[model samples]
Target: MAHLPHGRKLNFAAGPSALPLDVLQKAQSEMLNFNGTGISVMEMSHRSADFTEILTQAINNLQDLLDIPSNYKVLFVQGGGTGQFAAVAMNLMRLKPNHSADYFVTGTWSQKAAKEAEKYGKVNYVLPHTKQFKGVPHVNHWNLDNDASYIYYCANETVHGVEFQEPPSHNPDIPIVADMSSNILSKELDISKYGVIYFGAQKNVGPAGVTVVIIREDLLGRAMPSTPAVLDYKILAANNSLYNTPPCYGIYMCGLVFEWLKTHGGIETTAEKSNLKSSALYDIIDNSNEFYHCAVDKEHRSRMNVTFRIGGSNGNENLEKKFLEEAQNLHMIQLKGHRSVGGIRASLYNAVPVEHALKLADFMKDFQRRFGEPEA
Candidate 1:
């Protein structure tokens, strides 16, 4: 609830989102003399002992935070989540080289993941494709492929604001790969249920350069012959995420964030705060008498990203524009929705405080009162 540094604005961008102010200050303090190495983390050699300590400490903190099982290996790689889309297919498809992977597309990211996988091997849709992604279908209705190499899904869809509250029920023999790009560390998870979980750090973790991949040991070493060494999970794991330079600075920043999360009572406390934050915004939208609308189903609404409109279901462009302008005037930025969805999106990443969400909620209520049609 402490005020942000002077001139700092509340940020709600979908990715490349907010980093905790504490993390930023710590980074700034170490910028010139990281551990007295006399070089910035950006300048340190990945092979140097100082940098090795940073990397190892980072991995340990992340493992502790997630309680990552001993059977899984965490790799920090490049290319964001989009890169992993291909890596997931190339690595896992070869698990059952003759079979396909089942994709349950609930939103834009999952849809893109499925499409990218097709370049490597057959991708079967578990649910019939729909024009709009508003909510997840019942598991019973899903057309799952029991023989699939893996079952893929996105934990949270940034664009549609739909999220899977829990991993889908699937055959134990088939692995489950999840793109948790936008929602990792927001809550406690049963890590054992997943085969591979990958996330681009820019969302809730840290900066844009590093992508974290946590894959079960058995799933590694399965990349197709044509797979690039960089994108190959087995190669990255074997090298300890240093097969190449890796994202040293970004990974360092992620380490700080992880420590911040741990010091702030870890994932359990973070999840409680996240639920309160999203609920504050959703309550405003729900009580707005149709002045505001959220297309996603109530149960599937994302705790990380809340997407809605200023007007009715279709939205009122002028009023929405005015809302953004006013919010900017008040130092709240990046509330615009994705261009494809065309509305408003308020990303409540872990670094974002619940106080900010309440501030936005107050703004929404005031905006509605001033511009909304009077109820008779």
Candidate 2:
């Protein structure tokens, strides 16, 4: 807590998560005058040379971090990941007339994407879920349509704390679309594997009001007749993501965050640190015996969102409430699980340091010793 600047709590919210303190401090310093422009970033015109340079550098920095190929165009758009759900189907579905694109539904977000896509064109359910949305099922069990326009899946399901280590294999002709809203930049990835990767800026990037979309060149220019001009990727790409007013402030803050990542050795080192942080937290839950259980299968567990619940004989709502209260008292906030899936969730985002995660793990171990295995 003492190390945290501005007395900020250890935030673990799902989206709109934490941003690096250095980035915030820089933003604060530039709040009144950004780069001698004598105007706040929020007040600047998106067409101004200063803002354009910022946008250009941001894209280049991101491309460097993710090793994005020259063919991929990075656009900062509005409407977040949810907007892309419709945009993707409307644009990519034009590749084949009326072909049903496959969707691998793993959690709440994925299911929503599938439903939205149905409005644009036919949709294929690839690995359907029954009871709970936990770990991802095997690809062998998936019923994929090779002739479909493209295959869609959420790279990280924030609600259920499920994640796919990489994009799924599909017909070579069909592109793979991924919603990486929650886990983007938390680690290294094969950007080339996905034809389109979209994520809301609020999570690991910067703030809300902006969605970053990376689309391969080959996948552009195929939008359906009904696709809106604002939602069309090719149009946005042609304009270098400055098609309209745009989320100017969000893009500015995101540029700062991207610069911050590049200074820290990019995603390669970040992934190493993330692995350690997630491992420390997972170890506590695994060693708790009957005291706790993570619903997600081990292999597909998310390095960003760790979901679990108390499971001992003493486990109940009252104890869980007590746990949340105690966590807050200790300056750890937003540790409660999502309302949809009641339990506990600790979102280990890129900005969350490893020491904080270790502190939470220590607290969990202490809690188990006090209330769970008191007899021992």
Highest TM-score model number: 1
lDDT tens per residue, model 2, 1-376? 3546567888888878888999999999999999999999999998999999989988999898899999999999999888999999988987876567999999999999999999878889999666688777887888998788899999998888899887777787888999998988977788888899999999899999999999999988999877899999999999998888999999989999999999988898789988998999888888777688888888889999998888653347877888899899889999898898888999999999888898888888888877785554
Model 1: weakest 10-residue lDDT segment is 1-10
Which residue pairs in candidate 2 have backbone atoms (N, alpha carbon, C) closer than 3 angstroms, thus clashing?
none
- Per residue, candidate 1 scores C-alpha lDDT tens digits across 312-342 of 9999999999999999888899999999989
**TM-score (all chains, Cα) for each model:** 0.98, 0.97
RMSD of each: 1.3, 1.5
The lDDT for every candidate, in the order shown, is 0.92, 0.88
